[model samples]
Target: MTWEVRFSGFGGQGIVRCALITGKALSMYDNKFATMTQSFGPEARGGACASQLVISESRVLYPYVTLPGVLVALSQDSYNTYEPKLRDGGVLIYEEDLVQPKEDTGRVQMYAAPVTRMAEEIGNRIFANLVTLGCFAAITKIVSAEAMKNALPGLVPDRFLAVNEKAFDRGYEYGLELLETRPLSIEEAP
Candidate 1:
């Protein structure tokens, strides 16, 4: 089985880091094969950034995603750019506070999390990406909690590892709450 995941947001949001961590979780910890590719806009910070990961139980034959099975849109521009390319029955995870998503014409199952807000509550907004990663793990159940946690220590700065873990946990908790309620639309998301 293969899962194509695309993580998109503006620069400085750790878009590429999210994919790298997830790929590590899937490949090194979860016994899966993951290949990642990244894209950055012309400008450095505050510009469009995207990272795609192809995951499978076996070797990955393709490095790029044809139609992402999971689209994590953290910015409005990313949502607008990639939402239409999501495959039927795809999973859409977005920042509830940032992205105002359009109606999905296909069989896409959309989920929203207030990752940035949650990260701010944790402390700073920089941890928002980790929070989003937590939500991704909870909603998708593709990466194990143990795997996600294990992938953290080395990837993030030593001083901020604790905060990153906290952000991940917060997001994970919120995601579980969302799952329990199963909010139907972006309007229904909390």
Candidate 2:
């Protein structure tokens, strides 16, 4: 199976890091084939940035995502820029507070989590990406949470690992709650 995923947001949101961590977890820990690419604006922060991941059971021939099957959008600008490019029947995971989604097209499945707000509750907003990653894992079942945690070392500083792990757990649990309550399996978009 192959999955095309995109993680996008303004800079300083760890958009690129999200893809990196997921790719590494799948490829290195979960024994899948994953290729990743990144694009970002010139500025260090508050500029558009994105990372694309192509995950498969076999080798990946291409590096970019043409039509994403899974989109993780953390900002309104990113949701606006990438939502239209999502494939039919695709899955969209977004931050509810940060994005006001357009009317549903009835072709894609959408789920939202307040990752940034949750991160703030944990002490820093920097962990929002990790939280989102956890939500993505739980909702998509693309990779295991154990694999994600195994891939975190060296990527996340030792001092912040505990908080990051907590953030991930919070998001993962929230995603599970969403699935139980909202049912992402529904064919029609909500």
Please tell me which predicted candidate would have the highest lDDT against the true structure: 2
lDDT of each: 0.89, 0.90
112-180 per-residue lDDT for model 1 (tens digits): 898999999999999999999999988888789889989997899999999999999998888888888
Q: Clashes in model 2: which pairs?
A: none
RMSD of each: 4.4, 2.7
Per-model TM values vs. the true structure: 0.93, 0.95
**Per-residue C-alpha lDDT of model 2 across residues 88-174, encoded as one tens digit per residue:** 888899998999998876778899899999999989899999999999999989889999998899889999888888999999999
**Total clashing residue pairs per candidate?**
0, 0
The true-versus-predicted C-alpha distance at residue 85 of model 1, in Å, is 0.4
Candidate 2: worst-modelled 10 consecutive residues by lDDT: 181-190
Off by over 4 Å in 1: 104-106, 183-190
TM-score of 1: 0.93
Number of clashes found in candidate 1 = 0
